[model samples]
Target: MEKIVLATSQIENIAEILEPENKNIWAWIGKAKKMGLSDYALGILPKLRIHEENEMEGLWLSAEEPEYIAEILEMENNSISLGKVKILELCSHAVETLPKLKFHGEYVMERLGLEALFSEHTAEIPKIENNSIWIGKMKRLELHFYAIEILPKFRIHRENVMEELVLNADSPEHITKILEAKDKSIWIGRVRKVSPIEHAKRIKGKLDFTLITPDDQEENGGD
Candidate 1:
């Protein structure tokens, strides 16, 4: 009987520790750490919503396991907060796997966040409506080696009211494919050509390339 009572008390204590409060996530993280709990254990708490810039910041600072953070953000319902969370420099895996999470409905994230998180891995992330821009919060990330894979995913090629992106490729063939596909859908800054002079000249005119085209290859291309 005494063991049962202690167990009941422990359950209540955990419930209080894992209570869903959007504002004090950082504080809870500190408390949970003191109690020798893994940062991810908090992720299983139902109704836990992290929907603020500060809360996102706290999670980034405290959580060591990014997969848990990915799961926590997946439960977020606020579009505005989701926008802030995705741009964070978590692992490529965390950002790439977000689209596969079971969201409440169609969760359209800000395109800029996608640009930052999935720079080269865009093809790996499942399709989501990525168009909104949260002004004054633009982030710039260097191109990953395989960023050229973005050529086949047309969603990122949509013309935005405001955009600033740059691509650098090792081969002219890779750069050509990206430039032709982008076709001025968004503002692409001067591409740093590393292949050779002649290869550079081939894409020079297309470098300032603008004109959106249907990604006819999207259906057949494998990510």
Candidate 2:
């Protein structure tokens, strides 16, 4: 049995009830969580680790609503972030929040091709925000790269060859390196190009490069 005490501050409230030297803090936290006092438990936890969200809408909704996110983007503090994907979902599903977004968010949504609002608009959406950090799962290369190796977005056919920095991801040499980088941000210099491949058909234009798949380590073509 545990003794119960009442106090003002959180620490005073906890300390009055339990002696830290005699009590198992971690065990108490576990008991508190099991007893459905999670919010109360969190008041004493020293560190926090968040797991991934099971849904498109994540914890950011508690910070601010979709309207607030739209307002932040519109007003040029794109600095304050809601998840980009989550914002996209909100803009798609919650039509009420759409008008809250101004030019910048509208541009991104249109370029992402998520909504019909800009389907008829012809003006090009500009600004990739060169310094912004992008994080998302991406295919190692483009559809064109499946047929041919990497095709650099720009043709510097003969010049700037030394500037071409190639990264062979998932290679045997980098297997441990990637594993080491799992929890931390690996310093990738920049993303000069990104192409989204949403839909595709059989490549009737002949595959020049051999195709590899993870399952069975199968190969498609060689000669």
Candidate 3:
């Protein structure tokens, strides 16, 4: 029921007590925003209390809480890539307020800002036109469970510059089709328990694959 008003000095003091190694969470959040790590920042945003008086204010539930959140709306509005923020929050009230960005595709293009290697919706992959510049520039691609179903929709031509692929799936069977679909060699950077590491390595036609196995988790002290 108590509100911790946020100021530069106050944030630093609290962050020192909460995260000794990191001086302030706001610093990290700002860097995350600049680095386009919206998902990571959003994961911590729900616990925040948006101070009615000051939207930029940071108010956590308590000092004892393991996680903290802050109101980042003002920061987001002032971001260098404001359009990118809108694309990430497509269904939110923030995006709905922008009349110029009414159409999804054009504003998505605006959000891309000529540097995006790839983009996707919640469950749908963006349709890549033949003239699109991302053809040979996309070096890394990650396909989640639902995205796997539409794998056949896009073509990974031999000319593609893709060097890394990450398959996110709970069951090995779901991604088995993905491996079989690709005839060319792709460096699989990581697989999220989609298959036995050895089996994935074997069928994938390459020996190199990275997965955080239980042993690796134990060694790293587990997250």
Candidate 4:
């Protein structure tokens, strides 16, 4: 029933400081698993540790023999440490991806601080065949599940005969919500935003369509 508090970064470091290298570490690890230390916890324990006073107590417990219980305690400590590291990594990644600015054209490149970098590129809010639409790109990863991340922000008119599809913008959750909705037609387009030409092809004929671009073109690609 000992109490231990540690920051995410401190977990793995504490584990290493406390245990360094002990071949019997696996025994403690197995016991911790039985005790219900999650996979994350087991991985990070090497870095996390108790305060100086707690360390002294831990040392005493380890030396006191009973051996098996000491092993269990060690495993538990490691498990907790590993868990913290995972939590920290996930948090860090989320923060990195969170949108900093509003997803609108008003901010332009200045909002994302990409004005100078993207100076050559123009931000066009493409008009899809169906005025109301969303889109994104699809990608697959080994460890992570497949998902779509929206590319460009665009809209389609409801009256358009051709449908417009964006790639990678929609999540399964979003699609589920759309399917459950009363107005299914209004929610037309790919779940995620993707390349304009590609999206136009997907929704072509399904609805009257056009890709909104800085340059204007006829429905049949005519001037």
Residues 1-223, candidate 3, lDDT per residue (tens digit)?
1122332223444444344454355434433322221222332332222222222212111111112122332233212222222212122111211121212122212121111112222112223222121111234444444333333433333333233444445455544544654343333333334232333333344223344454544111101
Residues forming the 10-long window of minimal summed lDDT in candidate 2: 54-63
In the range 129-202, model 4's lDDT, one tens digit per residue, is 22322111111100011111112122322332222233221224312222332332333332121232322223
Task: Give me the candidate number with maximum TM-score.
Answer: 1
What TM-score, computed on C-alpha atoms, does each candidate reach?
0.36, 0.22, 0.25, 0.20
> Taking the tens digit of each residue's C-alpha lDDT, what string does model 2 give over 1-223?
1221112223345443345563365344322211111112222222111112211221111111232223223433223222222223122212222222221221111121112122111011212222132322211222121211112111211211121122322223222222332221322222232222321112211222223343424233312
TM-score of 3: 0.25
lDDT for every model?
A: 0.32, 0.23, 0.29, 0.23
Model 1 over residues 1-223: C-alpha lDDT tens digits? 0100011212344455455554375344333211212334434333333333321221221233344345555643333233132233323333343332222222222222222233444434324342322222222323333343342332222223113333445455545444564333433322212222333334433333232224322121101
Model 3 regions lying over 4 Å from their true place: 1-136, 149-152, 155-160, 179-223
Q: What does each candidate score in C-alpha RMSD?
A: 12.7, 18.6, 16.1, 19.8
